[model samples]
Target: MPYVITRLCTNDGACVEVCPVACIHTRPGAPQFYIDPDVCIDCEQCEIVCPVDAIFKDVDVPAEHAEAIDINASFFRQNKAVVGPVAFETAWQMVQRAHAYAASVGIAVTAAVVDEAGVPIAVGRMDGAAPRTAELAVSKAYTAAAFHLATADLAAQARQPWLRSLVVAHRGRLLPAAGGLVIFDGITIIGAVGVAGGSATDHDVLCCQAAFSVLETGGH
Candidate 1:
């Protein structure tokens, strides 16, 4: 289970600093930090460093702050896949990085990240991007997480008759598109990232690739 950041979090950011996987995050001007259940390694590093003693394991959370458990998990409800511990803050940063990469290449796009269970961890769209692009990005992410393969590769494989039926069986949840790539923690498939809204499929692919590269490089 994941650790919960309670009401006592003072926005100190110490947990964020100590997290080895960079999973803890506080939104801009937010009152407290939130631990991303998907990305957390469950190392208890955050719990040890919290000066306010606000962090607690899922089962140990105080009743008054009990709602925080759902609050933390609900952050990744959209899309669906079996994913490991991933920090919401890190996932959001990955989207931001992907968006910036698209902009750098003169493209406008939407980016999404999902955990292994295909649950959306974070999503972002550039100004003027089409509304449908967001949905496509998320669908592609879910496909990658479900298949443990990049959506581009899955798209190619799905061309076979048997694979095509498998794709159809998903009832539109599986989008075998080029812009989705699986994320890994060493050899373990942890999640995926998807990109859409570019003029061509290659543009989307480029954005997703760049985003994964950011994760590989420690989001530098």
Candidate 2:
């Protein structure tokens, strides 16, 4: 049996905090907290606190959300990937990690943290975060980390006369400059963090730092 958090959940986190066994991994900083079905007790407490009415039994899981069942399963299986051990971290934690650095630099920023597959896992906006800025941050981050190539590195490598033509063709689509970082567990790329409204270079550094913080701080 599986328990799923549906689209109706507003990510308020009340349900996440209430679980007795802590089967849920909804860290305070995650974008959307989810329950590991294998760990759930089929308890309805999560369903009880959800303000947006998003929780549901896996048996009654919506057709659109059916994929979540598999996602939950994949989350629990212990495995060693090229990077290292696979672990799940919350999106909120990712943003907070990046925000700590951005704060020091006096940059008000927002972030959209996502999985390697380009799915949004968490989104956060600091004071005055622009919509376009948030979007660009996510886009650039995804482009950089998904291909496992840094933006600047890519641009420099592309500068060869032969590759320049290819670079020109791709243009802005291949933002290898900075401002993005991979979210990973050991060797596995679990997700990514992107920040905007600051220097691209600084944002990039913070993005990575924040993601790493989640792993270190354990999503505080």
Query: Can you give the TM-score per candidate against the true fold?
Result: 0.60, 0.50
State the lDDT of candidate 2 residue by residue for 1-220, as single tens digits.
6578764556677887766335565445545667765446464667777778777888988898887767555555543354421233467767776777677777777776766655667777777666677777676566555444444455454454433443355454435556666655764566666666775566655655665676676662
Q: Residue 202's C-alpha lDDT in candidate 1?
A: 92
Task: Supply the global lDDT for candidate 1.
Answer: 0.80
Per-residue lDDT for 1-220 in model 1, tens only? 7799987888888898866445676657767878878666465778988999999999899999999988777654432354464578778888988888888888888999998888998999899789999999999998888766778876755665545665677677888779998888765577889899989899999888778767777762
Look at candidate 1 and tell me the lDDT of residue 44. Answer: 75
Candidate number of the best TM-score: 1
Q: Which stretches of candidate 2 lie over 4 Å from their true place?
A: 1-89, 158-174
Q: For each candidate, what is the lDDT? A: 0.80, 0.62
Off by over 4 Å in 1: 1-83
Q: What is the lDDT of candidate 2?
A: 0.62
Residue pairs with colliding backbones in model 2 are 29-92, 29-93, 30-92, 83-186, 83-187, 84-187, 97-210, 151-176, 151-177, 152-176
